[model samples]
Target: MTERIVVVAAALYDGDRLLAARRSAPPELAGRWELPGGKVERGETPEQALSRELLEELGVAAEVVERVPGEWPLKPPYVLQAWRARLLPDSPDPKPLQDHDELRWLTPDELWDVNWLDQDVEAVREAAFRGAGNCATSPNAPAPAPRQNPPNS
Candidate 1:
């Protein structure tokens, strides 16, 4: 049986920049850089889950703009749904609200610089090609390869 995994990320944008978090003490996987998000909760839609996660992780509200692309049925059994969001024009300043350490507004050129969680790497790769304008395109780009280097190689 395929283990179903779903993650919903808030594609937070401030003009040409997008917000990304460096996960510090993530409950499971710490020290990874991921877009602020979390697993979809039971009985909740992906959008609802995204909003909740944004609030929980960033101490800010997320008004979803559009569903970004680059989703796939991945190994480790995950089905991801990403969303675009407009941080309120006068959004209150963000505070460290969760396990993630720091936040940054990253441009497309800097997208690949962070070490990403296995599933989120594809989402990051897609961001550059899709532009920072929040295009609600489908999964037009190829998914990223699974981490297959022999353990401790």
Candidate 2:
């Protein structure tokens, strides 16, 4: 059987707001919003891949917070997963330096405002639900568990 392509996405947050990005490439996906990330490289853990991807794509350092609860299928060979994350302390605020042409911080209520790529909708909803609770309201909320490689690596 063929191995499935695993992609990891960051539901990156600063308090209650999740960062959403607009795709700038591969013409078909351009202008559609997504949680910024890319395919996991062989031998790299999901956390490592996501951190590397965020640095390359957003020009900022990210600490993957926790994996969101479920996975979604992309086109045939690809499956997507999401994690909650935060910018590393003292990191520059993320800029859309690659892959993405625009960035916006959206509160849970605004989650549906952007035109997300269809495959990302369920993951986005899960992310919004996870972030909308106490995490959004309490500045003192405990940090999520430390990064671990995504399941089914």
Q: After superposition, how far is residue 83 of candidate 1 from its true place, in Å?
A: 1.2
Q: Per-prediction count of colliding residue pairs? A: 0, 0
- Cα RMSD of predicted structure 1: 5.5
In the range 1-153, model 2's lDDT, one tens digit per residue, is 779989999999998888999888988887778999999999999999999999999999988989998999999799999999999997899999998888999886666567788788778777777864643322233333322321120
lDDT of 2: 0.82
Query: Candidate 1 — which residues are off by over 4 angstroms?
Result: 73-75, 134-153
lDDT of model 2, residue 113: 64
Q: For residues 43-92, could you state the per-residue lDDT of candidate 1 as single tens digits?
A: 99888888788888888876887787768555577676667776776667
Each candidate: RMSD: 5.5, 9.8
| Top lDDT hit | 2
TM-score of each model, paired residue for residue: 0.75, 0.85
